[model samples]
Target: MFDKFLSIDEEKRQRVINAALKVFAQKGYQAASTNEIAREAGISKGLLFHYFTSKKDLYLYLYDYAVKLITETIEQFVDPEERDYFERLKQIAQVKLSVLNDHPDLLGFQKTIFFEDSAEVSAELKARSKEIAETAYYRLFADIDKSKFRPDIDADRAINVILWALEGMGEAERARHRALGIDLDIPYMMEEFDRYLELFKTSFYK
Candidate 1:
């Protein structure tokens, strides 16, 4: 659908993409307005539809775009050689936070697409989400230095616990930010992650 858009000016294409991301992220697929997206992107609603056949088409495009961007960012920044699981997770978190800082709507946009129930493309979206998750899980543990883990702890379980704890902490931070009506502060969030990483390392590393 975006073939024509891609063939056009790169800057304008990105403007529309970002505008759609922000709107869909804020209001979800069912509620997002093409008019608002076009206005935000400084394009006509007719032009926006010209680029994408419809709102669903634009949304699916954004989903693909967001996943590709995140996958590329993780691949570029997360070191494959770091053997310590907590350290690797810290690196992943840092890269993720940086991306979220630059594209504040991306995470929200992804979460919206993954959980949306009423969309016609829900099945395809779920499949794409699963594919991304599987790929992420594989990359996260692949080639990690397992020797650093304490011998008594089951490596798989340890990794699962670490993942759960980190996710919980992140959710807590987001909740706090929401309650306080403050934007996510990357520095503060990273500091919290650093503290968690050190604690996990102290407990889990041999």
Candidate 2:
């Protein structure tokens, strides 16, 4: 019953969703109120409920929507002609990084939701997220040729390894800073991103 908003035009609905993202990210799910989201969107509180039944419903919808948004953003640059693993991997990484760059709120909203997750929260969101993730995994791996990856490398393991590396880049840098009590000397993130893609290319495809 809780389908993601596929038919809705983002241009029309984004005012609300984008506003809700900020409210939810800042206040967290428990503390965030619909009035706050409505105020942020400059809409009447009465109108907010017209779009969604409750804060939980809206957050769940946004969570599902986020998974789709992320994949669709990545799909735009995944050219079939760019079959070289490095070329393909670079494009994919660019896609992911660009999505994060443009929609930075998703990271915080997601962190809050994941931290607050429980059986009391919507199970549909959890199931849908898993389904979306599995589909993304299949789509990504389908683009790769088994012969290109290291013969000893487990396909699933390799995918998880790369995914974790992407997640760790910023956090690892922050951790280093905190441990030493010094400023970050991290190079340009995009350049690090480029270097990472090259590493995957050289290690796996070359």
Candidate 3:
């Protein structure tokens, strides 16, 4: 579907992707302008549309591209032999930090999609997001060593609880920063995340 876009030189393709990511992350699907994206990419709107048939198509393509890139990066960096659950989660978070260091706008674009409410792409986004989440949960957690967990507790349910709690903590922190009209403090966020992981480890580990 994106053969034409893929055929472009890497630098030009990245420019387009970065421009679209910035526009969509900021203005979201409903209000983001293709003209703005084109201008940022140093291309005409006609050329942008030539690569992507429509705005919706471009937005969805960006989402898929971002997910694939991030997923691959995580798989590459995270140690598969680390069977401890909390340690695995910590490694995944560190991999994300590395990805953000390289592609600053990618995380913001993904967060925007997570909270996207635009009628134009919300349904499709929701379905894709659900599928991605399930696949990620299975891939990341399914192989973790169960023996580290408390013997009396169900490790599966305990893992679910820990995931939900950490997710809620992340959402709350994002909301707090959004309310303050400031960019996220990644270092501080990581520190807090580590603290939460320690707490969870104390509770769940034998």
Candidate 3 structure quality by residue, lDDT tens digits, 10-57: 999999999999988788787899999999999999999999999999
Candidate 1 lands at a TM-score of 0.71
Global lDDT scores for all candidate models: 0.79, 0.70, 0.86
* Two-way lDDT contest, 1 vs 3, winner: 3
In model 2, what is the error at residue 97, expressed in angstroms? 2.3
Model 2: CA > 4 A from native: 1-12, 84-90, 122-125, 150-206
Model 3 residue 126 lDDT? 72
Pick the lDDT winner: 3
* Per-model TM-score versus the true fold: 0.71, 0.65, 0.85
Which run of 10 residues does model 1 get worst, by summed lDDT? 110-119
Separately for all candidates shown, the number of backbone clashes (residues 3 or more apart, or on different chains) is 1, 0, 0
How displaced is residue 130 in candidate 1, in Å? 5.9
TM-score of decoy 3: 0.85
C-alpha RMSD of candidate 1 = 4.1
Per-residue alpha-carbon lDDT of model 1 for 1-206, expressed as tens digits? 46788897889888888898989989988889999999999999999988899888888888888867877898898887776677777787778767877877887786576346665878878787668656765676688887888899887777777777876886787677667967556588678888888887888879
Candidate 2 lDDT by residue in tens digits, 1-206: 43333345667478888889888888778789898899988788887777777777888878877777877877776787665555666787677667766776776676566445445564765677567656774676475665667777775577667766865775665566667866434236568777876776576542
